[model samples]
Target: YKAESGEIFAVNPICTHMKCDVKWNTSEKSWDCPCHGGRFDCKGKVLTGPPAQDLEVVNLEQLIEKDNS
Candidate 1:
């Protein structure tokens, strides 16, 4: 995610609510969930939601390794 200061960050694509996948909103610069109107900031903090928690951070390298296996 891109902050107002232009800092970039990354977080999991999954929503904390209902385990729904989140989509990036480039214009708004946040992750949004269609399932329950959950919203997360670039830092993965909950902006608004049926979700009550921040988005989880995932290890990309581990995920890549797992995918290849």
Candidate 2:
């Protein structure tokens, strides 16, 4: 998030187009595509792409709990 103050906004770790890894793009301030030409902003809105849809977000705490057992 473009924090007015210090902040943390969480999102999914997977790409919407493919199962590629996403990294924090410091210069552009967004998640970048490594496999396809997909681009998603901090809040997970599709900025550019073959995948013209936002990445799916999952609740981290719930997902971790589900995976554990």
Candidate 3:
């Protein structure tokens, strides 16, 4: 996710709770899992439980390089 200050944060879109897919919560600016109500901040830090572990952070530079290959 890109913050208002122009900082970028990338994380795995899977919830650590039950391996469910996480969707963006625009109003809250967080990632929310519909299956278990797990919420995470833009940096993938757990904001609410059902999820105790933070999401895996993805390297933005690696992603960009891979996309260009």
Candidate 4:
């Protein structure tokens, strides 16, 4: 997600709880799991869980480089 401050936040979209996909909550500005109600902040920190671990942070620079290549 891109903040108004011009910072970018990215994470693996899979929920740690049951491997279900997470969806972005625009009103809440969080990643929310449909399966078990797990919630994560923009930086991928666990806000609420069935998940104890935070989502893995994706490397944006590496991804950009790979896409360019």
Candidate 5:
């Protein structure tokens, strides 16, 4: 999760459709799955097909646990 305006927002690094890693595209302000082309906006909204569901917004608690592990 990235911190902004005193709050945090983050998503799972992997895509839901095929378990592919989604990389951040700063220039495009979106996440794109390299394997299947699933796309999500920076806000985690579904921007393209193949993956119908939106990316999950990670909570602060979850993010803390992940960091600990």
Candidate 6:
């Protein structure tokens, strides 16, 4: 996610609770799990849970360069 200060953070698209795939919520600017109402912020911190842990953060530098090329 992009912050107002132009910092970017990324997280895996999976929910920590049940391993369900998470969808991006543009309105909330968070990752939401349809299965169990788990929510995570852009930096992978848990916003709401059944999830006792945060999502995994991914390093996208390589993928960004590859996509640009």
TM-score of each: 0.72, 0.70, 0.89, 0.93, 0.73, 0.78
Global lDDT scores for all candidate models: 0.85, 0.77, 0.95, 0.95, 0.81, 0.90
Ten contiguous residues minimizing lDDT sum, candidate 1: 1-10
Q: Tens digit of lDDT per residue, candidate 2, span 1-69?
A: 445566556678588777787777888988888888688887778888877668776566787799999
Backbone clash count for every predicted candidate, in the order shown? 1, 0, 0, 0, 0, 0
For 1-69, candidate 4 gives per-residue lDDT tens digits of: 999999999999998879999999999999999999999999999999789999999999999999999
Worst 10 residues of 3 by lDDT: 8-17
Cα-based lDDT at residue 58, candidate 4: 99
Candidate 3 C-alpha lDDT tens digits along 1-69: 899999999999999989999999989999999998999999999999989999999999998999999
Alpha-carbon lDDT of model 6: 0.90
Residue 45's lDDT in candidate 2: 84
Q: Which candidate is the best by TM-score?
A: 4
lDDT of 5 at 19: 84
Between which residue pairs do clashes occur in model 6? none
Question: Runs in model 1 with CA error above 4 Å?
Answer: 2-7, 59-69
Displacement of residue 35 (Cα, Å) in model 3 is 0.5
On TM-score, the stronger of 4 and 6 is 4
Candidate with more favorable, higher TM-score: 3 or 5: 3
lDDT of 6 by residue, 11-51 (tens): 88889899999998989999899999999988889999899
